[model samples]
Target: MSSLLVTGGAGFIGSNFVRHVLATTDHNVTVLDAITYAGNAASLDGLPEDRFRLVVGSVCDADLVNDLVADHDVTVHFAAESHNDNSLNDPSPFIQTNLVGTYELLQAVRRHDKRYHHISTDEVYSDLELDDPAKFTENTPYNPSSPYSSTKAGSDLLVRAWVRSFGVQATISNCSNNYGPYQHVEKFIPRQITGLIDGVRPKLYGAGENVRDWIHVDDHNSAVLRIIDDGVIGETYLIGADGEMNNKSVIELILELMDQPTDAYDHVNDRPGHDMRYAIDATRLRTELGWTPTYRDFRSGLAATIDWYRANEDWWRPMKAATEAKYAKTGQ
Candidate 1:
């Protein structure tokens, strides 16, 4: 059995991945997280104690990271300051966690000669024109728009450099937007889901024409596991499910699923420099790794997500008020 160190495992995607690994594999997992505002300790509840452990700490702590890396057979990095609006409000933490923290992990993995897998977002490719037929591919050039994306882009570059310059055993996967259970209410889909649960009208940014390619968190994690087992070193794969929808359509679907009027939503001030659309081409991952998403039906996946939030209100209720207040300040 492999010993895995998962940074930010208390966060949404990371937590899901932690559970996925435990349920599907024999790997013993240790989570190293700072338990930041975006992270929730409750998200990781009820796992087998013998195989799962959580470490409250920062990835930027080199000594701690090195110690963990030395013992783990592999490191899966999922920690970062990932919110665009939050990064716009304050870029300092983004730089510190995304750039410096990645550098520290790279150094530690290099020192230990351990296998590493870096999880990144497709936002690094910026956006395609709404009418453009192109989608972001593995070869897409980095053109990040927000401080969050920029810093993540920088972190991806650091991993590439480390792989080439030091031959650190590492691979990278840039995935499209992921939505499923345990997502923090601050994110787009969860915000709408939780808002509807609270009898609050969903809010949209601008005309809501912004497009995003969505994937289930479980599918993304499955692709990550695929890469770790069979993918070539220093290679980069793109993970997507071809689930593209505009902001307006997503909100309308949420309203419809929640038994509300389709038009019963509010328009709000748009975010600054909001990209028009984001789409991902996962041809490489599919053709090479033989991976496919289980939740190919967007509506069903979204409905399942809604049911999760409704049934598990206790998990997301704590952050709902603060998240809404933050958005209310900017009328978004």
Candidate 2:
């Protein structure tokens, strides 16, 4: 069994991945998280004590990172300042965590000759026009539009350089949008879900025509595991399930599913530099690694997600007010 270190393991996707690994594999996991506003330690609760541990620290701490790297057999780097709105308001934290933090992880892995996998987003490729039929692939050129995406692009470049110049055993995966349990309320899906729960109207951005290629968190984690097992070093893979939907449609559906009127939501000003659409082509990962996503039906997966949030009110209630307040300030 491998000793795995998952940075940001308490956050949305990382926590889901940690649970996935524990449930499906024999590997023992060490979670290194900074416990930031987005990182919820409670998500990792009830994990098997002997097989899991949490280390509260920053990935930018070189000494701490080196120590952790030396102890683990593989590192899946997931820590980052992921919220686009927050990044637009203040880009400094994004620079520190996404760029400098990644460099530190790369250095530690290189020094120990350990395997590394960098978790990134499709936003690094920028947005496609609404009418464009093309999707992001492994060969897509880098053209990030926001500070958040730009820093992620920088991190991906760092991993590539480390693989080439230092011969570090590393792979990269740029995944499309993820939606599932443990997601912070500030995200699009959970924001609306919690808004409905709190008797507040769901807020949409502008016309809400922007589209996102959705993938279940579990499916994304499964792809990551497949890559670690069979993917070639230095190769980059794109993970997606081809579940695309526009924001307005998604909000209306949520209202319908929650037994509310379809037109119950309100539209607000859009964020600056909002991408028009993001789609992922996972052809390479599918044909090469033989990985298939289990959550194919977007509505079904979304229904399960809605149930999760409904049943876990205590888990999300603390963050609801602040998240909505922040959005209210921007009129979004």
How much is the lDDT of residue 279 in candidate 2? 97
TM-score of each: 0.99, 0.99
In candidate 1, what residue range of length 10 has the lowest lDDT sum?
323-332
* Residue-wise C-alpha lDDT for candidate 2, range 1-332, written one tens digit per residue: 89999999999999999999999999999999999999999999999999999999999999999999999999999999999999989999999999999999999999999999999999999999999999999999999999999999999999999999999999999999999999999999999998898898998999999999999999999999999999999999999999999999999989988999999999888889999999999999999999999999999999999999999999999988888788777777
TM-score, prediction 1: 0.99
Clashing pairs in 2: none
Clashing pairs in 1: none
Error of 2 at 228 (Å): 0.8
Which parts of model 2 are misplaced by more than 4 Å? none
For candidate 2, the C-alpha RMSD (Å) to the true structure equals 0.6
How well does candidate 2 match the true structure in TM-score terms? Answer: 0.99
